[model samples]
Target: MENTRNVLDFFQKIVKEEPDVSAAVAAIRTLMNILENFGDGETLRGLSEELRKATEEMKKAECSITSVQSGCELFQRFITLTSLEQSNFKDCKEIMKKRGEIFLRKLQEARPKIARLGAPFILDGHKILTHSKSRVVLQTLVEAAVISKKRFHVFITESHPDLSGVAMRDELLKHSIGSTLILDSAMGYVMESVDLVLVGAEGVVESGGIINKIGTYTMALCAKEMHKPFYVLAESFKFVRLYPLNQRDLPQELKFSSTIIESNHSNLLDQHPQVDYTPPGYLTLLFTDLGILTPSAVSDELIKLYL
Candidate 1:
């Protein structure tokens, strides 16, 4: 049980990495290390049980779609290890190590491919608006601006309570990309001038909608109202089996209780939500490692990968 808790803690800790994918990747590497340290059958069972517990723990912690999906992916690999032992393959450690490598390589290879595929949509002179920060979104913008020389201005919402948008603005500046930060409520005010909307997803549900930062739905609604195309830049791993008809169906982990107000203003300090779902109709396309996908095509992709 102790080891199980440690495994869960390790996954949750690494998930705090700036880009959600980096956090997922870090957790995968740490899991690899954990597997590498286990050489015998008896302790391996403990680790295997711990892996199952870790996945459950992830659900409670509200890990992002990629992390939870990757946990499932890892569990599949664990099944392979057990199968190998039954087949009398004695070098179990070596087999597990190789499996981990294949999985890690698959994840590492996805980021750049997604960026490259998504970059072309950011044409010259396009003023793109994004809510919250996403490493994939940032990388796509950078790829378009730097390597492709696509000159454009980026407008970001100051994703409140966390202000992850500030980090995004700074990152854009670091890459020599131009960006402007705006207050969350000012989205509609600026919507008319924006050519497109680009945002990252915590999870892309089976309904062809995305679960992203709290303001994403509002931003999408505004974009939809203005006839502006809203694009979601995400990897396939962020796709999940959930089909939420409304916000309440989402897991509790997606919400946060920040002490936004304190002391004298104690009564005003209500909990803040961290994410919300944007229906498929609000999005124009999803740029993923699987290529440019229509909102409705998300389910097909999920079926292709998981089934």
Candidate 2:
């Protein structure tokens, strides 16, 4: 249990220190730490089990673990691939540590690559509508304003419960980009004013749809009704093997926070869902490190990585 607490502490420290880092990437870094500190007596299987247990413990903590699951799973796969055909256990461990560093470097590069690809979409005088606070979305807007020298306005939702969108608005202001914070219920009202919708995802499912902060679907629906384009900015590492036909299809762990799930509240209606699914049909295009991809193209990329 002490080790579990240590693992959770490490994960939380990474998040607290680097607010821009995604929870998924923090989880990956924590797992990498486990590999780096592995003892010489530990077997390969034991190390894998340790990483698996750390992931489960993280999910139980009072935080969002939606993308963490996918990140940890992909990192585990990379470790397995690195472990193949190694006679000496010590040599295999060393190889995994080296390869893990490379994997992490690639992930760090994904955000800038995605930002560059997404920045061009924010043309001068264009108004972008984004929900919640996405590091990728934030980086893209910064890139457009700082690098591309484009002048654009942004409409951000006052994402409820956390009101993370307000922080997004403030961050934009820091970059000298004009932005407005509107109520969550005002998505339809603001739809006509914005030229396009851009959002960051917690996970990009197999259906090419996205699981993101709550109210993302509402924004997408409004964008669809108004004939405005809806774009998603996400890293390819966030692609999870989920195919949800509707909101109910999402797992409880993904929808609710760890605290809410553990509670035995008599009125279940009081429990708020942290995330929602936006179907592929509503999305215009996805800006990823892999390049601009249609909704249908997400599955192709997922197949390449997962299959």
Candidate 3:
């Protein structure tokens, strides 16, 4: 029973500490695997109940994290819950999928607010630029496109190393959406023509600032210089409570495989290329499941529910 509590605590920590979706998904899968292989029937039942509680906790945490209205206290409450083990792979997968779907539904609920912010449309076929591939952003854009009828042309940065943009570009093409793929360096040149900028956040801070893929900060800076509006399309669950007090003093860690580093043979090789942080000032508003929020207002709004 004590071991089960330890496992549960660890599960909650992974959900809280890991900012990356891939990391979170991987952690959840690991937990599910452990439960599936080792959990007894009683443990499985407990885990299912715990998962439901986690889902509820996640909803509250989302409000806190995205709105920047509160601290990490509420999320910490859920972290104290006990964990359960599972005995069946099928059951574990089903539970994870169900939880994921619930999370996605929460994201969908924010669509109306996202649409409202991008309102009055850019009539002259506004050029919107973004980097990295984001499923949430894609869904939001697709919905907007359907409503605006090709009133916007999207420019995507060919996210290097992973080149995830290619897949994104393909997906857009399938929808007959007009889009342009640009090299990361070309962002400045493209910024001049862009009317607005939109990107996805990997994690949002309590202050309403955001951490995203590398090059996002550069894009935001460029947008700031150009006096263009920059919006972040993200769900509340992506908000992470912990933050480095001194942003510049934070350790720079590698985000990708060591193989890429070992093969370079030169010290100048790319070491870290996964994500970057853009300060709150660079963003205009946060389009979240709850509503649109400004940097200063997010925390107050979040605090209403979770504090």
Pairs that clash in candidate 2? none
What is the alpha-carbon lDDT of model 3 when measured against the actual structure?
Answer: 0.60
| Model 1 clash number | 0
Global local distance difference test of model 1:
0.76
Instruction: Give candidate 2's TM-score.
Output: 0.96
- Regions of candidate 1 where Cα sits further than 4 Å from its true position: 12-21, 43-47, 58-66, 69-86, 89-93, 256-270
Which rank order by TM-score, best down to worst? Answer: 2, 1, 3
Clashes of 3: 5
Q: Which candidate ranks first by lDDT, i.e. highest?
A: 2
lDDT of 3 by residue, 10-72 (tens): 545665666333333423343444444444444445655655444333323221222221112
Instruction: List the pairs of residues colliding in candidate 1.
Output: none
Q: Which runs of model 2 end up more than 4 angstroms from their true locations?
A: 265-267
Q: lDDT for model 2, please.
A: 0.89
Report the candidate with higher TM-score, 2 versus 3: 2
Better of 1 and 3 by TM-score: 1
lDDT per residue as tens, model 2, 213-306: 9999989999999999999999988989899999999998888877777784444477888999999999999998888999999999988876
Give per-candidate clash totals: 0, 0, 5
Residue 194 Cα positional deviation in candidate 1, in Å, after optimal superposition: 0.9
